[model samples]
Target chain A: MSKIKVVHYINQFFAGIGGEEKADTPAELHKGEVIGPGMAFQKGFGEEAEIIATIVCGDSYFNENIDKAKAEILEWVKDLAPDLFVAGPAFNAGRYGVACGTIATAVQEELGIKSMTGMYVENPGADMYKNKVYILETRDSAAGMRQAVKSMTAFALKYGKGEKIGASVEDGYMNQGIRVNFFEKERGSARAVKMLIAKLNDKPFTTEYPMPVFDKVDPMPAVKDMAHAKIAIVTSGGIVAKGNPDHIESSSASKFGEYDIEGLCDLDESTHETAHGGFDPVYANYDSDRVIPVDVLCDLEKEGVIGKLHTKFYSTVGNGTAVASSKKYGAEIAKLLKADGVDAVILTST
Target chain B: MVKEIERAGFPVAHICTVTPISMTVGANRIIPAIAIPHPLGNPALDKDEEKALRRKIVMNALNALQTDIDGQKVFEG
Candidate 1:
């Protein structure tokens, strides 16, 4: 098989440019070059594919001047006409992820070339474009670069070679919610009966749809008066007393901590610390109130902006914690705050 | 989780560094966090300055709860 030509897309940071400072760099194209993650992708392609060119753009630039950036990118991509357009494994950088997703989807939609991008499942870009093009599931941060590249490389090879693409579950991509027809040995009635029997016998049966329909909540009225409000504190930033006396696990905490700030006006390193293991904990360890703002609440109370601060605050680690666990914690915390006559809460998260 | 708290009927202002993520998840009342690890305050500044910054952020959160909203709203500090 001949080597399949490929074009790569990345942001300025991945192009070895400055971080946020260079986020406004304009779009540029480099021929016959492999940049940052493209090196890994090139290696993964391993004789099956060749990265003919690299497309680099600043995240802020692309997002800020979307129409211009996209038009320029589309023109360059059309000129190259590569077999595949492989965009970023964007991790959690919002603007970069959106740019990658946008360019990939547009390349495929307008130019009729196969395109793909990679990002964390929850990235807003993934939501906006997963249905428009193939988006490989990736970790929330750059720490997961290797795994993301490996999965994306495999998918690119298969798709570029005109091989049949499998279901998103089997292909390491986000489910686009597209209905697909597949051959089934049994009739619909027979399959339904089998499913019913499985349910009756307490056996596991996979449902056709895996995602739950989103539950929409009507926005409640805002607080009427700040001066009379009794405010409470809650966090998924994992701000807890030193040593984590509640023994809450760093991530996926099954329980939450309820610490008293009865008369204390400030939280210092000696008295409180973070149990969160997600990000750099240096700052949070130096000052727990940085995460929970106990000191600020006290100042607000003294200033009469708030009637009072709740004596107790609720906290839990949000790092990798399941939605169900968080929801449960919130319900319990709300109950307690309501019982204490608290009028509002300031919930912080990492 | 912030959504659940609101569902329980008490007003809640979610302070998070990534306001986009909060908006994507449908957190109704939102306040921008200063940083991810230290959402309420930044530790890089002088002690007194950090305290004031924290105070400003918390005040914004408090103000957010009082302001009525029809949908996702991000309160400024």
Candidate 2:
């Protein structure tokens, strides 16, 4: 059989293009050759699979204009005649991983092609798209480059040969944490019996597979009277003073600031600016009212729909903040709101 | 975000464009919004339509606050 053709997708950096400045560069298809990391994969897979084309675009370009990027990239790959597609070994770069995962999953879904990418476990992109494609668990840095490439190539070769691929771990990919029915070496009854026997014998027994534990939260005491409840408006949109006096970091914010707007009816660009770096800053800057909508909430409060508006609005940047940090911030904000006798909160996110 | 807020001891409701994700993530109550960026109002539309959509969703959210449910409840009218 002839060598299976493959196409590789990579961000601008990996394609020898510059950083954010080149982020808007449109998708380009290079035929008959492998780019940087593709060469490594090609070497590993040998002639069993050949990278016939390389599609490169900037991370910001794809993120900002996802539909256009997807259209252009898919159109480019349509003519490449690739049997398999591969995206980045995106290390711990969140944007790169997201770009890779998005494109890989899209190609797999839309074009019916086998697609694979690699990302670290902590990369949010993995959690978002892992269920849709083969995502190899990779090191935080490129230290695992050789091994990652080799493993990805092995899976690609198997896909090209139409062989039965095993579980994610067995196939050298991260588990998406979804389960499917598959024939097992041991029966369910036998496994259960063994576990029971071990437990009765007072021996340590591990579950065959442990389910993820979702922290159960005790429900809050309901407000006695909705009409008498003091409602507060809190936002993770990072609406801070123009200079960001509290110095909240854009993405991974460690601190939250409460701004007093006691006499103010509305927040304007001169008074507030977005510390959120995730979305376009233009809209939030020109119209701080859009992100927070405190004016609307205040109007409702004046209508006696709520008892009182909190004197201070809590603000923080939500983008790329870990769940743990977010939880901590939530608890802190809750404590403050509770102390002030605020019965309810209307929190918004951009 | 709504889950974290509710978990912190407040009856919380989420006004989100993606109801499926919020519902799956165990949001106590959900009110569907227009889109991700402009959840309440759509600048592209005329002021009347924008107000109507916002009013409808906001009302639904307020209604969600008053009602009790056994599990994650999505407001649909």
Candidate 3:
């Protein structure tokens, strides 16, 4: 049987060429040469796979000229046409991890071969390429090379042999945010009940799905004067003009609406309604001011409690909308409001 | 969205029934709304009474905007 050919990728430090001083070295391909870390990986692979070639590039050199380096590296990888491409267990080195992920993803995507890499979870490259390549989780530094190589070698052999790759947890790889399915011994309800019991008893319990982290924004200083300040209204409660003119999605809002409320004193059933599908639309439809507070804003303006009510108000349905889309809408709205000389905003939501 | 508005340098008073969600999303100024459907009015009360409730809530929101706060703050209606 022919040995599975492997192409290994490493930075200058791992290639025994130099450290920070040699970081500007250009890309080089060494035929049948096992560099520093490659020796450990080779021993791990044993007779199952052979390190056919090693690709080396400097950290600074590769990252500074990514486009040029990628093309050069891709050409070399294609020429070797190895069965498996193994990039660095880069640890926490930012540039090296990025280089590994970039090249490994390109080799798999461009060359139609299996590629794998390893790096620490917090490395910026992990977020950039984890979803594209098989990234084995490694320690923050090189002290964990023994364990990293063992896992990588095992995975490389399985992939090279055309065996199915298991879930990230079972295969000892970083979670790539891809959902995998397998039947559990206990039903989902039973598992939930068990987890609840453990939680109630002050015991540790792992959740099936981890919650995503949210950004904490520091609050800005409040507007100083209510009597002379220009105020604006914005809502995520799906308040829009009557007939739903923009056709904004009733649930996961695809767009926002800006209506002229210049001389309007109140929002009644005839003039406004809600496009939100998350809550009961009856009360809001009966009186749109219930959700937007446009009526009260106008009252405040007349009573001189506020200097002026901005002529236009922005509205959108926040239910089930993607975070990315919401972010886009917020940025655009802020730009518009800032340009309009709106000093403060009353943001209403359901 | 509230966070985005505040980030753009415009102070915002977020009125919502779900105060916890509002607080969690990093809204600087928070004012409690009546309920989910009718944030300003209470349909269960008399028309005049409901109007009074909404007016109070809106006044609170306006007051929240003018109050100088360093971090997340909940204003009472």
**Per-candidate clash tally:** 2, 0, 0
Worst 10-residue lDDT window, candidate 2 chain A:
A215-224
Write the residue-wise lDDT of candidate 3 on A1-350 in tens digits.
Answer: 67899999999989888765577689999998999889998998889999999999987677656789999999998999999999998986666887899899999998898899998876656767889999999887788898888889899899888898888888888888888778899999999999999999999998999987667777777777878989999998899899999999975578999999989988899999999875668889998888887777888899998999999999998765655677788888999999999999898987
DockQ of 3: 0.28
lDDT of 1: 0.85
Tell me chain A's TM-score in each of the predictions. 0.68, 0.70, 0.61
Among incorrect, acceptable, medium and high, the docking class of model 2 is acceptable
What are the runs in model 1 whose C-alpha is more than 4 Å off? Answer: A5-44, A50-129, A137-151, A162-172, A180-212
lDDT of each: 0.85, 0.75, 0.85
Alpha carbon lDDT of residue A155, candidate 1? 98
Q: Rank the candidates by TM-score, best first.
A: 1, 2, 3
How many Å off is the CA of A231 in candidate 2? 2.2
How does model 3 fare in lDDT?
A: 0.85
Best by TM-score: 1
**How far out, in Å, is residue A254 in model 1?**
3.3
Stretches > 4 Å off in candidate 3 = A214-350, B1-77
TM-score of each: 0.73, 0.71, 0.52
B-chain TM-score, every candidate?
0.92, 0.86, 0.93
Query: Between candidates 1 and 2, which one is better according to TM-score?
Result: 1
TM-score of chain A of 1: 0.68
